[model samples]
Target: MQTSKVEIEVDTQRIMGTLASPDTGVPGVLFLHGWAGSQERDLQRAREISALGSVCLTFDMRGHAETLSQQRYVTRGDNLNDALAAYDALAAHPSIDPNSIGVIGSSYGGYLAAILTSLRPVRWLALRVPALYRDADWDVPKFSLDRKDLAEYRSSIVSANDNKALDVSRRFRGDVLIVSSENDDLVPHAAIASYRSAFINARSLTSRIISGADHALSTPESQKAYDSLLLGWFREMILGAR
Candidate 1:
């Protein structure tokens, strides 16, 4: 396999991405990181997936890490735009098989992935602890969770929860996977449950909940479990395993 660091221009900004591919030219998988995450943070998982014979491209979301700018992380739509732009860049790459594109997103990225499936020809989607609903119990900073901000967030959450985008997913048609942590504190189980309900009702969807994992799934045991589940799912769905 070969690995390279690349950047694609989106609007006036440049987004950083890492590409890993097998020599045999397999399908491409795009990984979108959550809020404040960087492509480097997902290198381990990207390399692991690449070893399974699929190209993996992971990039930083707007206002995070290498893509960070003066712009604030204010809304989901902005992040979704970044993800779409990255997808366009990957699709245009000479080595990638555009029709076989898959996406895996974590947290905020997971929400964006679900939304993107509605707009793009995403063959497969894997959402890890996705923030499907904005729960009041989550520990958001007071300044960021002010009334005006809260209202905006609530609007976005409601719009998404109402299946406005999932309706689009149903129209586009694709396989869907939802992964959740049973003990996630930051994003409550109820939120993931709501997302699961919405997804299942919208189209064929599979879900798995890690018994003891948290929102980040940062522990060694939890991380390993997530890796195993995700890798196996990607191999089967994107790599054509029986």
Candidate 2:
């Protein structure tokens, strides 16, 4: 396998990423980092997944890394567009099998990845402690949203029809893997239950909780648990599909 730096143009500005591809054409896996995180966070995991005979991509979403100045101004919609552009760029890679694509997202990235399934052809989806936001603030800067209100909303029961990402999950036909942190305070168990109930049409749904893990998987043991689950799922969902 070989790795190379890549850039994707999104609305005039450019975000950077790394691409890991095998010598032969293979499935593509795109890794989306959490909010406030740069592409570097997912690089090692991407390389590990790529070794499983796949083309993996890890990119910095706008408002992160080189564009940190825009953090306060970047809205969910802008980040969604970044996800779209990254997906397109990955699908277009010469060594990628566009029809067989997988997406792995953490926290904020997981929310965007859920919506991306509705817009693209994704065969496998993996979300780790995915966050949820109300649709009312479509264009509002993410940072400006009331954390108290957001927390209250997440804690309350929400139906699949009432949430955009959950609604998409209802119609998704591919396989899904949802990883919840055992002690995730930011995304409560209710959030995970909400997602679990929304995947009515998925080909398969696998849900697991990382023992004693926090939302960010801050501890090395927690991180190792997540990596193990992810790689095992890829082996079953991505490699097994072949």
Candidate 3:
């Protein structure tokens, strides 16, 4: 396998990424890490996937890890922009087969992946515990005084609901696989229900809940399970004999 650092221009900002490809030709898989995560944490997964005849591109989201940004988690739209920019970067890679692209996102990254699938049709999507909800249900942290700041948060909530995976399910023309934990604390069970409802309607989705797993699913056993499930799902959806 070979690895290289890459950068892509997104609007005025430049996003950093790492590309891992095997010596022989392979399909392309883009892995988006959670908030505060870097490609380093996903190197193991990338290597595993690359060994399975797929190139893996892992990147730091804007304002996270190596891709530093001025803005924090100001709004959902900000995250959407980052995801789209990453997608564009992956799509433009010279060695990647544009039509065989797939995405795997975890936690916050999962939410972005779900939204991106609706915006851009891909071969497959593997979302690990994606969040889907409106403002009324979400526990948006409050640490602002000015009305404009409060308004931005509220507007962000509204925008999130309007652009939810449920509402955009019909637009996702590819197969989807969702992996969630029964004991997740950060994301409520209701969010999983919402995702299921939407995916069920789409009729091109598969899902699994790891017993006793937490939000991060970081336990050694849980990580192994997740890695196996992700690998199988991607192989079936993107590289299998169809």
Candidate 4:
């Protein structure tokens, strides 16, 4: 497998990313990081999936990582645009099967990924601690978002809870996987249940709770388990590995 850095422009903002792919054509997977994470955080998963005969694209949102300069300039809507643009660019890769694109997102990324699947064509979906999903319960700091942006985020969340993401996901009859930690303090079981209820017509929805993991899955054993579960889900659902 080989890896390379990439950047795609969504209007003025640049979405920075790392792309990994085998030496042949294969499925495509995109990785989205948590609220304060960059594309590099997902290198391990991208490498593992690429080695399994798939191409992976992991990128930083407008306000994080290599693109930190844009932090104060972007909003939740911009984040959605960045994700959609990333998928459009990734799907066009010569080594990727456009129709077989899957996505894995942690925390903020997971929430965005779920929303993306509702509006886009995603073959498989895997979410980890998908955070701030209920916009009604979330608030962007005044330093991070203006009143207008906050209104938009809250509105999006209301849409999400009203069956926008989940209902839109009904168009995708592929597999879905939701992973949560047993002792997560930030995202409770109720949040997980809400996400599950969103996938009303999924072909399969597999939910797993890490026994001793925290919201971050900090323990070595917990991290290992989380990694294995993600790799396995992509291997079978996206890569078709036996």
> Candidate 4 on 1-242: residue-level lDDT in tens?
88888888897757778889989747889898887688877898899988888889998888887767767666666788889999988898898877788899897788788879867788888989875433432234313534454333433323333654445554557789999999887667766776776677788999999999998888899999999998888778764532
Writing each residue's lDDT as its tens digit, candidate 1 over 1-242 gives 78888887776777788888878656778898877777876788889888877778888876778546533543566667778888887787676777788899898788778778867778778888775534443333322545554334433324333455444444545677888888776556655655655554433587899988888887899988988898888777755632
TM-score pick, better of 2 and 4? 2
lDDT of 4: 0.77
| TM-score of every candidate relative to the true structure | 0.83, 0.98, 0.82, 0.86
C-alpha positional error of residue 67 in candidate 4 after TM-score superposition, expressed in Å: 2.5
Better of 1 and 2 by lDDT: 2
The list of candidate 2 runs beyond 4 A from truth reads none
Q: Rank the candidates by TM-score, best first.
A: 2, 4, 1, 3
The C-alpha stretches of model 3 lying farther than 4 A from their native spots are: 67-74, 133-163, 201-203
Query: Among all windows of ten consecutive residues in candidate 2, which has the lowest summed lDDT?
Result: 233-242
lDDT of 2 by residue, 1-242 (tens): 89999999999899998999888748999988889998887988988888888999999999999999999999999999999999999999987887799999999999999999999999999999989889898899988999998888888778998999999989999999999998988999898889989999999999999999998899999999999999999988776877
Error of 1 at 157 (Å): 12
